[model samples]
Target: MTSDDAAQPCPMPNAHRRLMDCHAQWHRLHEVYFDPHEFRLTMNSLVQNLRNVTWLLQKQKAQLVGFDEWYLRFQQSSGSNEIMRWIVKSRNRITKEADLELLSELQVVWHQDWLQRTIGTSSKYPPRMSIREITNDVMRRYRPPFGTMTVRRRWVDKALPAWELLDATSEAYTRLEELLAEGHSAAAVPMCDLEAHDRECVTSSLRASGTRPHCMVDAKDDLEAHFDLVEGVEIESTSLVIERDEELIAKSVERYGSRAEIPTSGPIDAVPGFMANARQLMETDGEHGTFVFLYRGDALIKMGGLLFYNQNSKILAFEKLASQVKAMNADGVLVIAESWFARPTKKEEELGTVFFPARDRLDRMEALTVYAATRDGKTAGQISLVTRDASGRAICAEPDDMDDAVVNTLAPILRIWAEMDSSTN
Candidate 1:
C-alpha cells in the first residue's frame, strides 16, 4: 500500500489537483480561469493609460461578443433587482432628501445606484465599461426644452468613458510650465478662463488647422475649462408694426368677399423651374422686401423679401429672396413693412377654414382666459375678420392655435381689412 501510494504521488487532495496533473501530463492543456476581482481591477487600471483609445477597446469588446447578443445579456443582468436598487441608492452621495428624490426619479427603478457614495468607494469606468448605460440614463433624465435637443444620435460614441489620472507633483510641475508660456501653442496652452465648449472647439480647430504657432493676444498659460453660458444675447425682433390705410384696406376687403372662394393648393410643379437654389439669390440680392404683380391676372405674384438679411448665418440671399433694392447695389430691408395679407395665405386657402359660432367666441363670454405673448389692450385678444356664406350668418375667419405668432400678428390686419371692406359690401 505504501509503495502504491508513493507511485500515485500520495494521491491528489481533490478533483482540481487531479485535473491539474492531467492538464500537465496527459493533455498538456492550460486550464485557465480569470479572477473576477483581479480581472476587473486590471481593466480599471487601463483606464488612465488608454484614455484616447477607450472607445476602440469597448467597440472591440462589443464586436467580440456580438452587439446584439451581448446587448440582450446586458439587458438581462444590468441595473435590475432589489439589490441593484439598494446599490444605486447607496451609491448616490447626495444628502438632501429633495436632491436624493430628484436623483431617484431621474435614475429610474433599475438604474438608480447609491452604493458608491454610501460605501465611500466609486470608480469611473472606461468607455465601454459602464458609460453607455449611464449616458443613456442622463439623456433620459433631461427632458428636451427646445427642438434643438433632438437628442437621438447626438450621443453616438462621442465621449469615451475614461478618467485621466493626474500625478499631483508631476502634473503641477508640467502645469507650471504651461502656466508660464502663451497658451496658443499646444506645448504651452493654458486651459483657464475658457469655457469647456469654447476651449474644446478652439483646441480642436487649432489642431486641425495645422498652422504654425503664431503670436496670440492675451493668451493665458494654465488651462481652466468650464461649461459655457450665454451672456447678454441680443435677440433683434424680426417682426415690426405697420400703420394701415383705411382706404386701401377697404378695397382689399371688397376684392375678397366670400363668393364661393376657391382654394389655392396646386400641383407640386405648377411653376416653371428656375435654378434649384434660387432661394438665396431672391433673398439677399436687393435692399429689402420684394414684390411682383402678375400681369396675366393683374394681381400680386409670389412676394418675397426684397433683400433678406440672415442675421444668424450672416449670409445674404438676394435675387434669391426676389430683391430689387440697393447695392451693386441695395440695402437689406423690408419694403412692405410687416404687412399681413388681408386674405389668408395660399396654405390656409388649401387647408379650408372651420367656423365657430358667436356664442363660442370668448370675446362674447366674460372672464375668458385670453392668453397673449405680449398684450396691447386692457383685455388683449384677437378681433376676427368676418365673412358670410349664403346664409349671411357671421363667419369670422378663424386663425389656428398651432401658429400663435402668425395668428397674433395677422388678426388685426384681417379685422382692419374686413371693416374697410364691410362698407363696400
Candidate 2:
C-alpha cells in the first residue's frame, strides 16, 4: 500500500492487521548496529585489511566473529595492525557490552520526562523529565558504579539519602571517585569493601562493579565537557603491556594471619600513567610522533596480575598488541603513546606493519610525563597529563578540577606525520 493508504484505517481482518503491524515494526527498526553513531564512525574508518576481510567475508561465507575471537587475535597482532583494525574490533565488542549500561542511561532519561510533567502536579506520581529519575522510578534501585547490586527499597533510601535528586548526583559522584581510588589502591584487603558497596546500591539502580568502576578517561578531571577530528588524526603505537613496578605494594592476601602485615599501596591501576623517553623529534615543522618506551622496572607481565589485571592474564594472548599502519585517503596521521618508561626492544621492539607518510612520525613525539608508581603513601601514583615543546608552544595543563578555560588550553595537538603505503597505489 502507498504511504497514504498505509496510514488509512482499513477493514482488514484482525490477524492481517497484527501481521502488518509486526512487519512494519521490524522494517522500521534500526538493526544496523546497536549504537549507530559509534558504529558508523568506527566502521567508516576501517583499515584496508579490515575492509578487505569484511568485503571478502560478505562476498563469500564469512561470519563476523564475536568479541572473544577478535580479542585474542587482536591481542596477538603487531602494534600498528592491532591499533588499526583490532582496536576498532575490540571497541565494537565493548559497544555490545555497554548495551546494558546504555540502556540504563536511556531508562533514566525516559523516567525524567515521564515524571517531571506528572509527578507533583498529577494526583498520582509526579513528572520527571530526566533519565535518572525515569530509571529510578522503574527500577526502584540500581547497583552502584562498583557493579554492586542493591535492594530496591534500601537503594532508594541509601542512594537518595535525602530523597532529593541533587543529593543523588552528589552521592553518586563521591562514591564513584572513592570507588576508583580504591581500585587504584587495591584496597580490598578485607574483601568486604566491594560487597558492602554492592549491598548499598538501590534496587532501582543497575548493579555496579565496585572492583574497578568504569572510567571515562580523567573522569573527575573533566571540566563538565566532552569530539570530531579526522584531520590530524594520527595512529601511533597501541601497546598493551603488563609490568612489575617497584612501587607496586600488593601484599599476598594469603598471609591472612601471618606475622607479615599486608603492605600499603592500592588495588590496581587498570590504565595507570607512566612516563617513557621521548620519540625522535623534528624541530622544523612540529611533526612529532609518540610511542611508549619500556622502563627498567617495566617488565612485561601477563595482564591478569594485580598491577595490570585483566580476567584473562596471558601475555601471549594479545599477539595483536602491535599494529601496522595501512594506506588511507586521509590527511596527516599521528601515533602517541606514553608507555612503561622502559624500552622493550633494541629496534622499536614492535615495529608497525604500516609505515606513515614519514618515519619521523614514529621517531618524533616523545613523552613529556608519566604516572610513576611509588612506595610512599604521600606519593602514590597519580593521574598526570604532560605535554612537551613538540610544537614550541608551551602547553600548560591544570588539575582536572580546574575550570574549563584552563583545561581546554591543552586541546588535542593536531600534528600530521607521513602518508601510508605510498600515495601512488
Candidate 3:
C-alpha cells in the first residue's frame, strides 16, 4: 500500500496530529524570531507542543508496535542531550513558576573592499529592532566604508545549552520529528517524506498544510544578498563621481579589451523607440517588463526578459538572465527596467520608524537605470531621466553617468560573461 493508504489504517493518529502541532509551533517561532514578545509567546507554545507529542505517543504505545522500546531509548538519549534537557526544563518552568528568560544579541558586519568588519555588537531585549532598522541606524551613526552590511540577531538563554536559542529549538524539534517518524514505522504507517517539500518552501512565507516538515533556513543567504542590494544606493552615495569621458573609457578598454564600450557621450535617439518596442512586447507577450538585449558589434543579436519579483528573488533571476546572455556569445548586454528599491535614509530612522518597509516608491531619475556589460569583464551604467506626464506618456532624456555601486553590482555578471567568452573562443 502507498504511504497515504497505510496512514489511513494507523491507530496512533492523535500522536501524529500532536507531532504536526509541534512542527507548526516551531515554524511560528522562526517566523517571529525578531519580535521579542511574539518570540517568547511562540517559544512557550513550542515547548508545550513538543511535550504533548511525546505524551500522546506514550499514551498510544499499545497500538504502535515497538513504541514502548522506542520511547525508552528516546528518553534515555534526550535526557543526555543538554539542549533537549533544557527544553524539558523550560517547559516545566513555564508550567510551574514563570516564563523562561531570554537574551538577544545583535551582530552587525560591514563588508567593504573585500573585508568583513564588525561594526557593532550588543546584547539587548524587549525593544528588539528588525535587521533593516538596525542597518539604517548603523548607517546614521557611523560612516563605514562603502559596502553592504549583514545584521544577525540571535536569542539565547543562560539556562539553556551554549547554543543560539533557535539552534537549540531546531535541534529539539528535529529530535521530536525523528521520534514521530520512528513511531510511524513501528505502527506500520507510511510516513510522508518532508525533506524535499521543506526545501521547496524555504524561500516562501507560505506554510505547508497537513504534516509540516523541518524547515531549513536556506533563505538566510538570499536575505543577506537582498540587503546588500537594498543598501547599495547608500553605499554608492559615497563613491566619487567618475564622469563618463575618454579617460574612463580608456581605463575600461585597458582592463577589458576593444569590445568594452562606455555609455555613449550623447543621447541615443533609438532608446525611446527601443523602450517603446519593449513595452509593446511586454504587453502582448505577457513577458516581464525588464528586458536584456545582447549585441554583436552594433547589431542586436539576442533578447530575453524576466519578471521582477521581490528583492530576495532578484539576485537569482538576474543570474538566470545573465546566464542566457552568456549563452548567446554576444559582445555586450544592455538591460532596461523599472523597479522599486529600498534605500537607506537617516530621516526615516530619525523619525523613529522601527521597521523599514519594503520598496514602495519609484523615483523618476532612478526609473531608467541601464546596466551594460561586455564579454571582457567590462561594465558600465547610465541613469536616464524618464518622466511621465498626467496621461502617463513617458519622455526619455539623455542618460547620465551611473555610480561605482552599479559597477560593483555588475561585477559577477561581467566575470561570468568573460569566462563564457573565454571558454567558447
Candidate 4:
C-alpha cells in the first residue's frame, strides 16, 4: 500500500462523544494490518450510507405524519393511480427538509380549494379534493423540467431501473418501500375489517335461524374475509418522526381553532375584471380587444357568458375577435345564436372558417371558444351562453351548427344584457 493510503479519521461529529473516540481505537488495531487510505475511503462510504439511510427513514416518517384525510381516503379507494404515479415521480426530487412541509401544505390547499368549488360554503365541514383534481393540480404545479423524459417513458426507462438498483443496494430504501406498501394496506384495513364484521354478523344471524348448512358457508366466508384483512397488516412505525407544517394557522381561537391558511389574502376577484374587459370589447367598434386571465398554471381557465353584436358588422371584426381568443392559452370556444336560421349564418361560417380549420391543414385550429349573438331585435330572444360544466374538458364547438334547444334556453340570457349597450353610452 502507498503512503497516500494512510487512514484519516472520520471528522464528522456524532451525538455521543464516546462513540466519536472509538475511531482512534479502531485505527490503532488496524495500524499494521490494512492500507490506511483504503480504510479512510471505506469510512467515507459508511458516513454517506448513514446519511442516505437517515434521509430515507426521516422522509418515510414525515409522510406518515403528514398524511391528511384526503390522502388517507385516496389510499383506501381504487381509481386512476395518478397521485401514486406523481408521488413516484417526485421521489428523490425533494432536497431540503422544508420541501416535505411544502408538499403537505399544498395537499391541504388543493383539498380545500376543491371542496369550496364542489360543495361551496354550504358544506358543514371542509371536504377533500377528488383524486382527479388533485392529480391534475400536482401535474400542473410540479411539472417535470424541460427535456426530462415524459412521465410514461421515465417510469419504464428510469424509475423501474432505479427501484431495482435501490432494492439491491440499500436496505433502507427497501424498508421504506415496504413501509409505504404497509401504510397503503393499513388505509385499506378499516374497510376490509368493516366488511368482515358485517359478514360475521350475517353468519351469526343465519345460524340463529337453524339454517346450519347455509350458515356454514357464510361462516367460512366470514373467516376468509377476516383473514384477508389481517394477512398483510403491519405494525405502524414508532420511530418515524413527523415534521410540523407551518402554513396551517389560526383564523380564530374560539370557533375554529385552526385552519389551513392560504398564502394569499383570498381568492382573486376575477369577475369585476372580466366584466370590465367584456364591456370594453363590446363598446369598441374597430380595435382588436381581449382580456386574458390564467385560471390554472399558464392555461386559461374555462369561463362562460357570450358577447353579442349586430350581424351587419364587417367580417373582419369577427376575425379579429377570433384571432385574439386564439392567441391566448385557451382550449375551446362557445358560440350562442339568437335566432335559428335554417342554414349557417355568414358570421357563423366566417367564425367556423377561422376557428376550426380543416384537421389536416398546416394552421389547423386545435380548439375554439363559442360565441353568441342576438339577431331578433326583441328583448325576448337575445343571445346567451353560460358555464354549465366546471369539471368537464374545455370544448371548441363550431358556431356553424347551433342546437335548437340550447338557443331556446340561452336566448333569454341575451335579453338581460340589453342594458349593456346603454350602460356603455
Name the top lDDT candidate.
Answer: 3
Per-model tally of clashing residue pairs: 48, 92, 0, 13
> Once model 4 is optimally superposed onto the true structure by TM-score, how far is the C-alpha of residue 70 displaced, in angstroms?
6.2
Off by over 4 Å in 1: 1-151, 154-340, 344-425
In angstroms, the error of model 4 at 395 is 28
Residue-wise C-alpha lDDT for candidate 2, range 1-425, written one tens digit per residue: 22332232221122122222322222122122234354334333322223232233233223222423433343343234312333344345545543211111121111111112111111122221232343334444432221111111111112112222111222222233232223222322211211111222211121122211122111211111100011211112123343334433234222211223212222112112221111112212233233222111223212211111221111111111211111111121112323222223334546733233221354442223222221111112222233456646423233121111111101111100122232122
Q: What TM-score goes with each of the models?
A: 0.14, 0.17, 0.45, 0.20
Write model 1 residue lDDT over 132-248, tens digit each, in one string.
Answer: 354344345642322111111101100211111111111211221221121223223222221122122122112212111211101111111111112112222121122234565
Worst 10 residues of 4 by lDDT: 147-156
Which portions of model 4 show Cα errors greater than 4 Å?
1-79, 86-279, 290-425
- Give one digit per residue, the lDDT tens place, for model 4 in 1-425: 11223322212112111121222222322231123344334333322342343334344444443345433543443133322333333333332221211100112111111012111111211123332344344445543322111111000113223221111122222222233334434444211111112222221011111111222221211110100111222111111011122332121222333233322211122222223333233323212222222122222333322232322111212222332232221222223222222233477577763332233345333222223233223111112222213654323222232243233222323322332333223
Minimal lDDT window, size 10, model 2 = 407-416
Decide which is better by TM-score, 1 or 3: 3
Task: Tell me the lDDT of model 3 at 137.
Answer: 66
Residue pairs with backbone overlap in model 3: none
Candidates 1 and 2 compared: the better one by TM-score is: 2
Q: What shift in Å separates residue 198 of candidate 2 from its native position after superposition? A: 11
Best by TM-score: 3
Candidate 3: regions farther than 4 A off: 1-6, 110-120, 123-128, 146-148, 192-216, 219-425
